[model samples]
Target: MLGVVPSSRAPNPFFWLEDTHTNTMEAIAMTIGHSTIPRMRVPALLKGNMIDVDLASLEGQWGMLCCLPRLEFCDAVFLNQFRRAVQKQGAALLGIQHPAHPFLAAHLPKAKILSIPLLTDSAQRIGRALGLSSETHLNQCQSFIFDPEGVVRNKLTHSFNWHCMTLLLGILKQCQ
Candidate 1:
């Protein structure tokens, strides 16, 4: 599936979408990050904790919404490179871990899991919201993109590929 539909509450995309065609291509690339995070709503799993990491504090900070396990696998090298990319730019990288794949911990430690215990409804809601209806082929998994202004910039329902990384990295470059 592609990215979620930019909520009506969010602003227009063209205005916020970076001009990735400029000569300074790298200068205007977007950073991969997280936004409109639903986890903020479910506090019971993490409620009233003033002594922990502040996910919201990462707002305005370059983000990368690293969705996990579409094909029951995640490349460690790719993940390392991804983290390295975002880290190099001093941007924040947030991992949107779902309940389906519980094995991400084997390789990732710093990743913050959103913990979506409920799967189907959340998956469909995200699919519709992101206008991923066209990507019927990628229905197997869910992952999307968002701009700094809360805009769902790009959507990916399929597994991570080299092209995906290039695109994600390009976004990260823009964020920097």
Candidate 2:
């Protein structure tokens, strides 16, 4: 059985399950820990208006981008909490979903009401760049924390659970 271990590097609270024999897992862990957010243009809805924006423009500000399969009413509630937390730390929070996800379309009104920016990744370009895309889980939920310089300071895969949320908040505190 694998056990999770926290990295000794202070202020970087990323953790990985120990599995010395799994080179694939080690490689992924390394890639995520060191990779920076890629530059790309995508359509986004902010404050009820749709706009095309370049992701690189987000540099110089602490930001958290959460990629989820779909947005539900409950998920919206959670996002609201996350929004407040991010804002409290002087960071921006964004949510991304595949444009084809029906749930997000259904919740567009509520999504627009939220203060955070909601992005529509029509071509999965962001997903592919972040290595979160797959044939089966094209819209898997994940959370990424970026420093003002645009470096990926921390990331949570398969997120949205209570544990992940707690970890995310902790990471935000340390990063800020």
Candidate 3:
């Protein structure tokens, strides 16, 4: 499902139909992301202010879009190791957390010191788009890999751990 299309958009598999599609065709296209979609954007910010990261604008760089329940999910040590692992593969990690959590008050200062581009999603806008919610592991952490063209190459929704991180790294390698 991750890499397969249900049907060819055109008689030739390599050619996608353009211009002149009826309303029905357009409706069908809209349902594509129920499994996989073309783009995922990450608006990076820190401490309620924007941090200037435009993940969708990245041409050839891989992006790891991580959604955390609270700031504590990205503790200083974890951020350092996570950043190093991502950077080692020539990729970037972007994180999202609840904007008004108490943990932010205590841990965001340390995150700022680490220069992590942790974003605030008090309204759960991005989280919901990625299918995250309180019912899910009390807002368990999740991550998605966006390739250079902004397609979701892979995704993970689980409790975070070093072993999972290592497995993610391997998956990223395969995507590359």
Return the top candidate by TM-score: 2
Which rank order by TM-score, best down to worst?
2, 3, 1
* Candidate 2, 1-176: lDDT as tens digits: 44456666523444554555653221112224566777877777665677677888988999888777666666677778778877888888888864356425433666666566778776777777666644335424677888888888876665355445655677678877
Q: Candidate order by lDDT, highest to lowest?
A: 2, 3, 1
Clash-forming residue pairs, model 3: none
lDDT (CA) per prediction: 0.40, 0.66, 0.56
Task: State the TM-score for model 2.
Answer: 0.69
lDDT by residue (1-176, candidate 1, tens digit) is: 23323334445441122224542211112223343533232211211121233434545555555545442223434555566666677655544334344423333323222222212223434433434333323313344454454455554443355545665666546534
Q: Give me the candidate number with maximum lDDT.
A: 2
Model 2: worst 10 consecutive residues (lDDT sum): 23-32
Displacement of the residue 171 alpha carbon in candidate 2, Å = 1.3
RMSD of 1: 10.6
